[model samples]
Target: MLTNTVTMTTVEIAELTGKAHKNVLADARKVIEMIGGLKSQPSSLGYSEATYTNKQNKEHPMLVLDKHLTFTLITGYDTGLRHNVVGRWIELEQVANPAFAAQAITETLNELQARVNAMAPAYDEHVRKGRTVGYSWREACRLADIDHPDKLLAVLVSLGRARKTTQGHTQLHPDYERDGFIKTLKPSNLVVSKNGGHLFKITSKGLTEWLKAKAEEMNTAVAFAGVDRWGRPIK
Candidate 1:
């Protein structure tokens, strides 16, 4: 499995190599000492002391090593054991990269196109003739293939189209509103006072012109953002 940490513990190394944790710890210490004591040339040794809790809830000292130190420490091991460690290291490194994740999201979305089409019937015609209108915010999001309002807000923000307030209501950017892509709704009893009693919705032009472009853009943005450390991608 992929791990966020760049370093590996001697306990995990022992598991991978089918050795005792105590033995792995001894080997790690020897490598650390050969390079220099932990206090000297620490960077080259790439090790740090940590602790692990046992079944009895007692903490015991352990060593964590970065990739360089890990491989150096394992150099004396047989070929199969070294391969196991190398395989696990590759898995950990992949956690930091998002190219594969983006590709996966793209493929998933493509596979769901048929279902999206069935749910959003006539959406294309409405956009093509420039007559799209009368959709509530939720309906608009559904037609755009965005799974949630929050996800839609993320896509809009990435496209420089909208923003959300600290109070958690999303509002279109002034430039977009002025361009006739979106309009503010009159305050109603259902509107919350915290948002100044106003709600925003896409205009006819927005549904036809703006949303058409944004739907595709949302695909790319969702794929990239899905793997971003900040948020998950829109399904």
Candidate 2:
């Protein structure tokens, strides 16, 4: 039997991440694509998580984890990211210096996550409530500074970073036209519109999905996916 095609909308991922979905998903997806393709697991975190709060003692890191970077790590793990060094070229000093290997991997991971967040869809909902003329792949690529915004945007939307307008020219938004691509990304459900051509709100279900995205981070301290929401080890 022929399989039916599937597509994801920003509303779906916003629903997935439990945040205001809409244009945000598009923005996130664009930035992520601009950064480059996705990765499942990265080897490292280049920069340290900054102390986020400016208050006498604020919570969270100052250098917020770039959403795109998180997506890179997730996609990278699924794909294979080999170390650049040729085994023969590895030196004795490199072996002795643990920091060398650690730093390289960290940089890779940080890059991945940083890009994902940058491209995540976070559009102006009040402006574009429903669909309009639709976005051209080339135009999007240009705006986002991505070489292949078409492909990258599709990935981000499918993965829940951003979404596409369902009622537009599928040709412009290739994600709607692609069959297996959507199936592979497998978005959970639903898309929405607040006004003209912007905004996607996360559904109640998306809240849980965004929560699961927490699992996407690369492990810097030897723990796989490291630390549950409660700060407890996965064991």
Candidate 3:
């Protein structure tokens, strides 16, 4: 399982946090200095200085921080804003590890197809209506063996894959939406769309690609790989 070393630019950090680039650059340098002096091998240092072209095509200096360094740099920020950076890092990781992510999605799709096969009659009805790409969140939790939709939503929010609104409705996290794991839709009877807000539908890929892994990691009974829609034991 090879993974590329992912890095985030201080400029991007500025954009993410709504801060000035120069301020982010200064903060990054301070983080680098506080950690240690410049090393001969920047790769081992977790941060490196680079230049970016400005509006006038003039090169301006910036710092590129690795994952660990990025988290350290954002430690002082508000939790909500810090989440912005965290989401950005997740995107970078997916790009840096596309093979692993793609393989996961491919495998999840297979398992979902198996489930679809088991529910052929119902599935074919959805296929006929051309609505087979995703499952209503309620249906998603049911298929995953979650006892309650809120319980599943809580788990997803805890894992940073979903967000709970002040009104108590659950929305798919931006990171998951960006990665095509979940989609937001207008309120409908097919979904548990509360408070007249958008409903969340977990894409089939999301059910296994993202939710399954996190659920298993947390010891929650999500969709079991190699099992049909009925959650038959997969020994």
The residue-by-residue lDDT of candidate 1 on 1-235, one tens digit each, is 3335578999899999999999999888855643444454565558888999978999988898997788776665665676677667655665654443646545544443333334333434544333433455665555555555566667777777776566556677787678787666544535435433325766656654566446656666666766747665445
Q: Which stretches in model 1 have alpha-carbon errors above 4 Å?
A: 1-5, 40-44, 100-235
lDDT string for model 2 (6-61, tens) is 22233333333444533434444433433432334322322122333334774432
* lDDT per residue (tens digit) for residues 1-235 in model 3: 6469888999999999999999998877755644542446876878877999989999999988887788767765555566677666766667777765756645644553344345445534543322355766666545544455665566567668666677656677677778877777654445455422435667756665565445444434333333567878666
Model 2 global lDDT (CA atoms, 0 to 1): 0.33
Clash count for each candidate, listed in order shown: 1, 74, 0
What's the CA RMSD for each of the models?
23.1, 20.8, 18.6
Off by over 4 Å in 2: 1-122, 125-131, 143-235
Global lDDT scores for all candidate models: 0.64, 0.33, 0.65
Residue ranges of candidate 3 with Cα displaced over 4 Å: 99-235
TM-score to native of every candidate shown: 0.39, 0.19, 0.41
Better of 1 and 3 by lDDT: 3
Candidate 1, RMSD to the unseen true structure: 23.1
The CA lDDT at 87 in model 2 is 18
Best-first order by TM-score? 3, 1, 2
Which candidate number has the best TM-score? 3
TM-score of 1: 0.39
